[model samples]
Target: MSAPQHPAHAQVPHVLAAEPPRSRPSSIEHELPKVGKIVFRVQGIPLEVTLEGLEKSFKSHFKRSNSQENTIDTGLSSLVPCCYGSGHQTALIQFQPQTPKRLESLAPGRCYDFEDPDFQCRITIDQDFMGSTQLYPTISNLRIEADVVAIPGINGHAYGSWTGASKQNRKTMWLRDFMRKDFHTCRTMIFGYHSALLEHYAHTMSDYTEDLLQEVTRARGNAEEMGRPIIFMGHSFGGILITHSIVKAWISKQPGRLCGSILNNFKGAIFFGTPHQGLQHLDELLEAVKKNQGRKALLESIKFGNRDLEDTLSAFKRYCQETKLEVVSIKESRETRKATKGELGELARNGELVMFVAVAFSELKLPENLETTAMAEGDHSSLIYEQGGYV
Candidate 1:
């Protein structure tokens, strides 16, 4: 599929400073170790904290706590900022692979106190997804029958986007905890990309679409594996990316080619709160971008009556009709809280939020029986979490 051309003003520098390099192929193996190799979320961090400062404090704390044991390794592998809420900052902390028993000592739900000469803070820690682009093995005896890949929307975390606070106020990642139990024979995976709405040098939607295709191709490995049935689950803008990817694969289909193999095995897709037509609050979001000096290329492509989005959706529908691919559209029924920039550069709540995408805009007008539609109980951001019962 030919990528749509945007106005010159929508173009930005191609340099992707925020996006990390593609993860090592071996690091995303289907089977993962039970202990040392883990990614966890840290909450309650002050907005002013820097990655360097956070790392230094963690290293110091870990070293002090494990000083009695000379053999313990207290090295950190990576620390990247993640978005969980509006008021405070959150991050994903990953430890070095060599520390096989580290998690046993510092388990989830543990709180840590970090004291610095400049400031002091308390943070809560919890386990995150095993790794980006890795498959989640089934817990049942049922044999693996299909692959389910999930992609989060703009400003969404691969883990946090699918996770939500339950009625008991406990964080529940539905993909790992709930979907695995229900789809016993299906291997699930989550794809992460740099889609922050406010990023200054963010990649275009085409860039993300290509990255997703390449990662899935690498993850599937051999030809037989690539030919296995696959279902895609996308939320918000994620659904747009998925549509572009499928259309790309369909256009590039050829015998024995990777894209062809993927398109051949593509069986279905599920979209949660995806704006198939466009967002209802496009002007408001654009205004927010202007006020905050944010990137606009991606947002511009998804505005109401956007030629690119309409073309992509049309092509996606055509592909589904010819291939008989099943599709499920889950629309959000509530309003999502909007975050505004405060005087201190922190994101603050701006009164009551408005619905970003309307129900009509969220649903795809597919041919008669080609698509199934359902309404979810939460807002746009929470629609993915609502899939627990919908699935």
Candidate 2:
């Protein structure tokens, strides 16, 4: 079992200095310790981006000629459902030159300093997917350098010049995707989510749904054996995923009969912008709509259940019995136009749920000095692309 450690909370003091001096981490960079090392980072991105868009980000400019690859096998065979290996593990995957989008333009800087052991094994994606769980094999004398930043948002969002949040009101953000993988962690993770009745994942009834539990388990087991600490990172949809995974484990009521697929317990978790108690405004609105005009009227108001973000919040009350997991929430700034309804407060009060507040700041104007190269980040710029390092 990993020893319990306090949150490594960091705050960059706003400095009025002339130039931000070049800063480097004093500690040695983390290398994926075991074979088939997997790093899973979840990101909330607009739907416009595709697998192809990702193909472009890690190629030619991102790393050297032989840094990444198009495909690599995970050693696990066809029968094992969870194991996955990107064809491009050593060689960077490139985008078609004819494509109009120049992905690097999304972020201000094209040159990201990748410092991890296998710096070339960085995977770029609009959304952190099942393919994202793998770590590059550093044993091949992979010289570590600058950080391989996963510029978030859709391929368009990366360079499109629009920032706020996804229209879906997604609970995922930057940290999980772009940063967590930089340091090698020894743990396993399982993702779970209850079906949203009015939304995408719904069955004929809501009595009990163990839909994606098995797949999430297989994925974690693959990552664990490969030498990465498995963390079940969930958003509102994924929050439902983890919630149900644990509930299934607790329901079996056995010492070892886990939630269908998770091999054993997970090391730890860090959830950002998730709705644990449930979504407030939408649920009330849906309820009000149900009370007034019929279910049909409510359906029209909600974008045919797609915009009904509160369904997951209602799920906790409807399902899930385990309450022992330590969950943390990262809060949106007060400057947000649409305010989040219920907040679980700080870690001091809720031992299980620690909420981190993210404040958008104006870019600090610097008078340019050769002494400092630590550039100031735009208020809404993606953390992975902006700050670019471990916590």
Candidate 3:
């Protein structure tokens, strides 16, 4: 098995070689005082609106409220675009230092209407914990068996990516809400990062992989926690990131080190609609990014037939072979709607719908004993939430 290649063009932007291990006293660390931070998702935002404009609108609304006291210690912390659906844009808003009363005032499921001469839009607000990585509380009296971490793909939300609306229109996060019924003792977690298509300061693939490695290591602090068995579930491009991270852990030489422990305790992996070969619509997406003047570093790295990605896959296969890691690949059986130029100049889903990743590309050609392939009923985006036979 050959080691993974890191070509000159794919070098990390920052030096990470000398970084020391993060410290945590125990697995169950003491909880800190609440900072009164709240994050919400704003859906149906107009593409032309800037982050500054959105913040200003929120501030103006608060000022016009009758009770000015609620606005005293509250302020916008960050806003980033996220993928919700086709034909429209969405953003996540974070506010901090507000009282419990303020939180009740701006409750989840609340709707805000922003009206102006040029811009008029109604946005629905829902509580969001997209970028934070934390363990879900285990069921009482259930002895913990393993940790299952889920990572969302490109333009995917930590919460929304794995969530789907039920018949009653209630959002369901299957990993947290349903997985425990069967794997009763396994702790679940959702990992998120900035993978927006038009992000201005998008980090490199190496940067994201490093962040995942460090964050998860810190989350599972101490030797006992690190030695516990673990499984990873990744959707779309997230599967690629996991492959790289696992390969790094496999090659770590230091015995009893965190990275090596991750490799040692890695139990299995589940890939949802991942393009192990390459994305079919890479050219179209690249052209769109060029026309919009968005950053292209991340896209270029996953371009069709990219040599580096091919090498990474090769290395991952070798690791799996040596470790006999359990693997499952779930391919989308439906076509996904593509975003295209709209009549009002915003991206819409009027373009031709296509199967972005075919079954051949989604399923790896690993030995039959180690790999299993199945097809799911939904398109790429909904595959994560779909209760298909694959599960």
Candidate 4:
């Protein structure tokens, strides 16, 4: 036996000169056992799943678990409360009278944060855009959508008041109709439990971190109690938040004691359009960053992330830290998308958890009127919507 053989991902040349092969459709379709129930399709598959909270939190911003307890301000949550909903929309968002559950102004009865051992996450999306006109009208309700699928944020009973009047009957659901008599014959169960990215967006950065850690911890606790896989999935901005939080928690040792506390329970991660490198839409991201300049206040709140994104990812790959991570990303490529594909392939080859998936976006056929789509953009952001376009 000569030296140990390197895996294909390691032995292959960088091959940056070659363009990525034309992508094929991501034939992987998501399904569930029951049509509209919270039961897992495959009993043995796994029970634990988490769509991480914001990497930034406000309420839990100043809270600390310092052991030295000798000084003031040694442990605090946040100096200022987080703008979870739109801080501007004072009317649309409000916290519970005596609880941390942030409720929407429209649906005060709905609880954004609740504790239950039965389910690891209870997502509540309030996609109510009050601008009078909606940007993406294709979505249903023009309200909160789970996983970017264009559906209403109605609670309970899939067969909801599909054809009923509003206010009088709010039990109707749109996806239930699609699953009942669809041409594709897709399983109705996949749409069973709601998607986990139900962040109301009013959490402080620290609160976000702590909540994610709690989710991870809850997943592990659930696993220990029931035994299952602890998985996390994020897209776009969510992807960034998850990545940053992992580094901050384990590698940098910023917020809490994640290195020893929660690392053991982590199974793996699955990210769709997460930017491991940085912002894809540099202009938009740059503007967002600029508006958030000198975020010393915000920066101090984040006890996770390795100073930045690149450092966090690199440190993770090197195993320099331990956190809620086993796999980093699972991405799909459209045939002719302008974004980088070759780089994604390289990461997949590395023995890391990156995998290559294919998908068709918009069903846009080129000049030849091809039957299958290869040319597409990053559609992972919108994979789970009811309308089923790219998120």
Q: Between candidates 1 and 4, name the one with more favorable TM-score.
A: 1
Clashing pairs in 3: none
Cα lDDT, model 1, residue 66: 44
lDDT (10s digit) by residue, model 4, range 85-151: 1221111111212112222232522323333233333323233221111111122233211111111
Candidate 4 differs from the real structure by a C-alpha RMSD in angstroms, to one decimal, of 20.7
Candidate 1 vs candidate 2: the TM-score winner is: 1
lDDT of 3 at 232: 79
Find the number of clashing residue pairs for candidate 1: 0
Q: After superposition, how far is residue 258 of candidate 3 from its true place, in Å?
A: 3.5
lDDT per residue as tens, model 3, 160-271: 6775655444445556444444345666667767665644555777888888877677657666667778787888888888998887666665565558668878888888
* TM-scores vs. true structure, each candidate: 0.66, 0.38, 0.66, 0.34
Worst 10 residues of 2 by lDDT: 72-81
Model 1 ranges off by over 4 Å: 1-63, 66-131, 139-142, 254-256, 291-294, 348-352, 386-391
Model 2 / residue 204 / CA error / Å = 8.5
lDDT of 2: 0.27
Q: Report the lDDT tens digits of candidate 1 across residue range 74-99.
A: 23222332222234555555544333
Score candidate 4 by TM-score against the native: 0.34
Q: Which candidate is the best by lDDT?
A: 3
The TM-score of predicted model 1 comes to 0.66
